[model samples]
Target: MQVITSESVFSGHPDKVCDQISDTILDAILEQDKKARVAVETAIKDDFVFIFGEVTTTAKVDYKEVAINKLKEIGYDEPFNVLEKISKQSPDIALGVDSTESHEQGAGDQGIMFGYACNETKELMPLPIMLANQISKEMDNARKEKYSHIFGPDGKCQVSVEYEKGKPKKVKTIVVSAQTKSWINRELYEDIIINEVLTKVLDDKAIREAEILINPTGEFVIGGPYADSGLTGRKIIVDTYGGYAKHGGGAFSGKDVSKVDRSGAYYARYVAKAVVRANLADRCEVQLGYVIGISNPVSIHINTFNTGVISDEAIQGLVSKIFDFRPSMIRKELLLDEVKYQDLAKYGHCGREDLNVAWESVDLKAKQLRKLYEETKRASQVL
Candidate 1:
């Protein structure tokens, strides 16, 4: 059987905890000064959290309190040490991003950003990651409310989907491990995760049957940062497609929109989703390259994975017209400067439907692509 696996962790997971703290600080800074140039990273370990990165914001922020409050919000009430070593954005790097001769705002750094979309899931995301993320969110809700007594704030869910002829057929197995206050009955815990979390999250059509395992170690009383250290950008795979597509190797969290790594990735998603939503392709992936000190992308690439109704070349031409990959244009189109990123620190960043994330919107671009595809098709037939 052909099987693909993907996993997602709760917001209280060590890495995610760091992600939220970093983004929380970002949101605070943005709320005050929309033009803040912040690129904060966090590292969390047992009883301590370290915050370090470059900041060039005029806004006044209490870094330590931001870290402590974010940890507390994630249900960790312990007294942990907080360290800060943040500095201003380097002049060398700033020289590129600051407006200059020919461009409005140059890229924050030189890097490539990738975006992908598929019809395998309603969110246009790959089935394995979507299922994994949904289950993680479900379990997180249970921990917050009904099952708080049994489940701790830290947990992870993994789904192994069996594919038949390149299409997802059924779930092969599901593995879930949750942190708890004490060792509970294995059977009961397993049953709750299967019935309450997995069953509710997975659509019946997506998974006919599967093996479910919970807390394989038989206990998980120790978890969160106390169990392991977590650093920002470490969970890039989880933050994106769960290895279903190629990543440009850039992390999204803890960075401002000026960082092409964040904004460029978001813009690429906007473009890819537009293609899928326009019905130009059943799946699409967009890749963009930006160089420091350039307002426009150095290169843009698109692949329909042989699923495009129109030719991939035509789609590429159309995408260029519909979307702008320039760092300044991306910031303007997505309103990135005003976005509150803390809400996107968990579950997954790409297919978020609960928040007012602008990247998820594709109506305007979809219509434009659809119209162009039809026009091109008719013109080609006449030829």
Candidate 2:
């Protein structure tokens, strides 16, 4: 048996909190200015939430108000005392990203982004990551439902799955560390958390038999930003493919669609999903590269783990024929500037079929890809 490990962070976890705050600001700005160039970064330590990044837009917005309101919405209250401690973005980075020409729009900063897909889950996401995300979402719902006294805004979940011959067989272990107000005692907290939260969230029999660890280090009374320091772009793995694929090291939060790092990654996933849904491959991964000041991708690479009926190069040809990887072309195709990303900041971004994110739409492209795959397969057989 082979073991695979995957992890997820709760919305109130310091880094995730920072991510949500940054994207929330981005959404607000984009709502006002569809073409707004936003590259907001956020940091949280103790009671304070500090935001810094670049923004080039004509819309007038109250940054502080946006910060406070987002905090309140995330379940932090005035009595919690986390709201009064928020800050603004830096102007230096703003100068570079605030540009008129679409091509001249420098990356808010240099880094890489990754997109991945697999046949493990219905969503084409890796099994460990899919389970981890489901657990995190369950944690949020538990908090909303007040099911567990010991569960709070900040939490982390990790799942290790055992595989047989590259196929996932069973869950090996499940770990959850959640924060709570001091109202509950340790033993009682453990009971409610494990029995109600963990058990209820992972009701699936496959996960129920796994080793369960709840707050392994014990007391979590001090959690959230108060206990740790958080910065934007810190949760990139959590943002996209969940370390299941190679990342370009580019962060997504705060940057506008003009920046290929964010927009291009979305487009790559869009293409990858199409390939998998069309039965071109049981698993597929797509890589898209862009050079600065260029509209077209430097290169596009596809890997199908040998499950593809056609060679990867042939798949690439079909992709090149079918999809546009240019930055401007991607922005228009995916409707990047139009979608509100703030909601995506909290949940796992990729598997959201309900959100109507442009990348999630495979109806049109899937058919095209299916036809291309059939044509390529027939040609290969004849050869």
Global lDDT of model 2: 0.76
Per-residue lDDT tens digits for candidate 2, residues 301-374, read 89998988778988888988899766666777888777777777866778777688989888799899888777
TM-score of every candidate: 0.96, 0.89
In angstroms, the error of model 2 at 343 is 1.0
Q: Highest TM-score among the candidates is held by which one?
A: 1
Clashing pairs in 2: 111-250, 112-248, 112-249, 112-250, 113-248
Q: Model 1: per-residue lDDT, tens digit, 263-336?
A: 99988988999899999889899999999988888899999989998678889998877787878888889988
Which whole-number lDDT from 0 to 100 does residue 170 have in model 2?
Answer: 85
